[model samples]
Target chain A: MIALEVKKMKKNFGGVKAVDGLSLKFEKGQITSLIGPNGAGKSTMVNLMTAMYPPDAGKMIVHGVTLEKWKSYNMPTYGVTRTFQDVRLFEQMSVLDNVLVVLTERGVFRSLFETHGELHLKQAEEILKRVDLWKKRDEKAEDLSYGQRKLLEIGRAVAMDADIYFFDEPFAGLFKEMVKTVVSILHELKNNGKTILLIEHNMDLIRELSDHVIVVDAGKFFAEGEASDVLARKDVVEAYLGE
Target chain B: MDYIMHLSVLVGVYAILGLSLNLVVGYSGLLSLAHAAFYGVGAYGSAILMKDFGFSFLSAVVLSVLITMAVGVLIGLVLSKFDGDYYALASLGFSVIAFGVFLNWRDLTNGAFGIFGIPKPEIFGYKFLAGEPYAFLVLLAVIFTFLICYFVVNSSFGRVLKAIREDEKALQVFGYKTTLYKLAVFVISAGLAGFAGTLYGSYISFIDPGGFDDLVSVNLIVVVILGGLASLNGSLLGAAFFVLLPELLRFVGMPDSITGQMRQMIYGLGLIALMMYRPQGILGKFRL
Candidate 1:
């Protein structure tokens, strides 16, 4: 089943069309890599999809239901979660608290009295261990190394347990071991029937991991298909070199 | 003994103010300058209900808090549109407007003459007279406010507040209605400030528009900063220090004319030193 579908999505910032007439679909339990050169509106597409910026015109259908007047905060309720291109972790909070915060009850009154119980602790521990940050769980997020910070951000997304995970440049500025760790996480998420929309620049990693590929350049669709076919296209190669 | 009790009562009142404002400025990372407005509303609201309408103390306090909370919701809705320095500026503007109303509303507030003859709190036929009885009463209020702040900061809701403080946009992506959280904390903080105002009015037996001005709000911010941002104990310590310091300066024996100026100088210099050395405050874990 198609987990998420965007049709005729358009967004503009003054004279610049950040994301214009973009349409894409991702199926459940599949990994779709969204690739483009710099200034290709890749990040803007993710932002629009996650409702961080309202599209000037479009329709977003998730789980066969059309979302009307959806907001950024409502994305999680619709089983949508995302990581930023620049890792945005709760810097003053501990690694464990970062994950635990995502597991918190959203109801204001109920959460006012709610403490993190054993189940929350267990879930947090599981996520931290998976990210290999269990030992640094007590350390403040700001104190973590860049790669570790990236892991914590992903761990936070895992704690959300949402269906569609938008990993925007999740592999940026990471060591080889950390990259492998993230690769395994993406695979694990896919195995569990989660839809992953990954925005990445690494051609080899995209070729190795993507079940499907979609390319955009200057806020418009350039090419898309199997990763092997799309990456080899003359126009697609020129788009990257042209930039 | 009476003097000590009076000082203790002042400390207790300010402590409650500090704790309430801490929720907004410390945990939620919204620097609010309109706290004293709600504080004034509470004092004026409760004082009027009891003195004019002959309502009981408890009922007056309850109704006053509700009224202040309603005002808070209205103010919070407007404040939520701005962030950082703009939020602070807007809050200061609201506080100025509130003071203007207190000074200009002659019929309801008695104008610059202020409200007098605010009766001491009476519970179960026992009047909490000034001095020891009222001190004890205020002590109870301090403890109550402290526990409320403690429970709130320790809860999952508090965690989200800290997250909101760190990065509101990121928290929104996590499915938290951040504006709602911000509004909730703002209203709660306003209600608590109003509660403190009620306590102050009853203890002092008189309140003027002079008591709830923008300067008073700045002093409350000092109380929070000195005590420590995001630290409950810091609020108490900050309030105690704030209330006691001027009294201590009395023994310095400078000329009476310069004495007030001297106290102001000392307060300013001490805060500057604190910021330079320990910006987080005495017990604060977070620095703005």
Candidate 2:
């Protein structure tokens, strides 16, 4: 079943067409890799889908419901959540609190009086352990090393427990072992029947992890197929090589 | 001893102001300079309701807070469109406008003549006269305000506020209505400031536009920054320092001719030195 569909989306910045007439579909319970060369509107596409920026013209259908006048803050209610291309953790907060923030009550009045109960703690602990940061949960996010911060960001995403997850350059600066941890997390999300839209530049990891791949260049679709098939295309090579 | 009690009352009033303002400036990272306007609204609102409308002290305070919160909502909606320096500038403008109203609104506020002979608070047939009784009333108010701030800072709402301070955009993608949270804190902070204004006006028995000017809002900011940005106890400590420091300088016995001017210089120097060495303040976790 199609989990998310973007039809003829258009976005412009001044005279530049950041995301001009783009279209794509992401299926449920599958890992789809969105690959592109530099300045390919990959991040812009994620932003549009997540409602960070309103599209100039397009329709987004999630779970067969057309999104009309949606906002970034309400996207999670639609079971959509995303991580930033540049890791954006609450820096001064503790690692545990970072994950717990996602589990907080949404209502302003209820949240004002409600303390994080045992259920919240248990869920946070489970996510922290999954990211292998349980031991460092008490440490401030700013105090964590580069790799640990990435994992904590992932742990926060896990706490969201959304139907669709957008991971933008999740493996950008991780060590080999940390990459394994994130790869496992993607698999776990897929196993739980969550739609995964991944933006990554690492060809090997994309080939190994993606059930399907879609390529875009200069805000337009270039090619897409099973990962192995599209990555080997002549046009895809030239686009990446800038030939 | 009476002088000490008077200072103590002043401390209590400023403490409430500091705690409330910290929720916006410290926790939510909104640099609001219109706090004194809300403070004046509370003072003037209660004063008018009690003196002109013949309302009781308790009802006056309650109604004044509601009125101030409504005003806060209107101001907060406008301020919500701005962030960072623009937010601070807009809030400063509001304080100036509020001061203009207090200064020129002749029929209601009596213009520059000010309000005098305001009635003492009467609870359960017991009138709270000046000195110890008023001091005790303010102390109770301080305790109540402290508990409210403490509970708010510890709850999930406060957690979100701290996150909003760190990165509002990022928090929004986490499914938080950041604008609403910002508005909530701003209104609550304004309401609490108004609550303190009621206590201050009732205690003094007189209030003027000068008491709630932009400079007063700046002083409240200094109190919050000096106490520590995100700490409840820090607000209390900051309020104490602010209220007591200049009074203590009197004992230094600078020639009476230069006493007032000298005290101002020393206080200014002290603050500069403190900020130079400890930008985070005495107990602050975050630096402004």
Candidate 3:
């Protein structure tokens, strides 16, 4: 089943077309890796789909709900959430709070009356343990190391419990053990039948993890298919492989 | 004894002001200089309601706080569009505008003549006319404000404010309408500041446009920063220093003419030194 579909999306920054007339499909329960060279608009596509930046023109159909315009603040309510290319966590907040906040009461009336209780703490801890961050649950996010910050960001996204998770470079920099932890988390998420869209450069990891690959060049589609088939394309090699 | 009671009441009122500003500057991370404007609105609103309409103390205060909140929301909507230094400047402009209104809107505010003969707070049938009794009342207000700040900051709603301060876009992606959150804090802060204003107006039994201006707003901001950004106790500590330091200087025997100028200079130097040595302020956890 299709989780999200993008049709004729166009976005431009100044004179540059970041994402130009791009049409794409994200399937449910599948890990789709978006691969491209530098400035291939991989991240821009995520921005447009997530409504971080409004597309000059586009249509996003999520679970058959057609949306001509997507408001960035409505994503979580729509059951969509994303992680940043640069890990963005509440720096001053405790590691546990970073996750608990996502699960906390969101409505103003309820927020004032309700507090973070045992259920919220238990869930936050579970997500933290999944990322092996339960030990540092009380530490501020800014004090975490580079790799830990990435894990925390992932942990926060996991805490959101959103249906569609767009991870922008979740595995860019990490130790082998941390990478394994993330790989396991993603595998578990996939096993749970969650839709995952990842933007990554590591071909080996892409081959190992991705169920499908979509290649883009200069803000336009280059090729897309099964990992083996798309990665074998001559144009994809010329554009992305720097051949 | 009366002198000390009066001084303590001043501290209590300023402490309430500090806590109110801290909610915006410390917890929510918005540097707002327009706090005293809301403070003034509360004072003037209560003063007018009670003096002209013969309203009870409780009714007047509640109405003034509500009026201040309405104004706060209007200003917050505009301030929400700007961030960082721009946000500060826009707020400063609002403070200036509010001051202008207070100074020139004579028909309501009474302008330079100021409002006087404001009655003491009377609840039920008992009138709180004594200095110690009023001081106790002010202390109660301080405790109430502190408790509200404590619970709100510790809640998840407060966590989201910190998140917005860190990365607004990221919070929005998580489906948080940052504008509403910002506005909420702004209105709450304003309402509390208005409460403090009412306390001040009732305590002093008089108020003027001069009491709420750029200098007063800057003084409140200074108290928030010095006590420490994002620290509730820092607000109390800041209020202590802000309210008492000048009073202490009055006894230094320096001429009153130069004393005012000298005290301001000292405050500037102290702030500069604090920034150099402890940019985080005395107990600040976060730095602007």
Task: Please report the candidate that would top lDDT against the real structure.
Answer: 1
| Every model's TM-score on chain B | 0.98, 0.96, 0.97
Per-residue CA lDDT of model 1 for B81-197, tens digit only, reads 877999999999999999999999999999899999999999999999989999999999999999999989888999999999999988988888888888999999999999999
Candidate no. 2 TM-score: 0.96
Tens-place lDDT digits, model 2, residues A1-243: 999999999899989999999999999999999999878999999999887888898988999999756788988988999888988999988898899899989889989977556789999999999999999988989999998998999889989999999999999999999999999999999999999999999988999999999999899998889998998888887767343
Q: What is the lDDT of residue B108 in candidate 1?
A: 96
Tens-digit lDDT track of model 3 for A1-243: 999999999989999999989999999999999999989999999989888888999899998899988898888877898898978888988899889878888876577666557889899889999899999999999999999999999999999888889989999999999999989989988999999999998888899989999998889988889999988888788768775
- Give the CAPRI rating of model 3: medium
Q: Per-residue CA lDDT of candidate 3, range B150-269, in tens?
A: 988877778888888877887888878888889999999999999999989988999999999988999998899899988999999999998788778888777767877887888899
TM-scores, all candidates, are: 0.96, 0.96, 0.97
Better by TM-score, candidate 3 or 2: 3
Q: Which window of 10 residues has the lowest lDDT sum in candidate 2 chain A?
A: A234-243
Candidate 3's displacement at residue A224, Å, is: 0.7
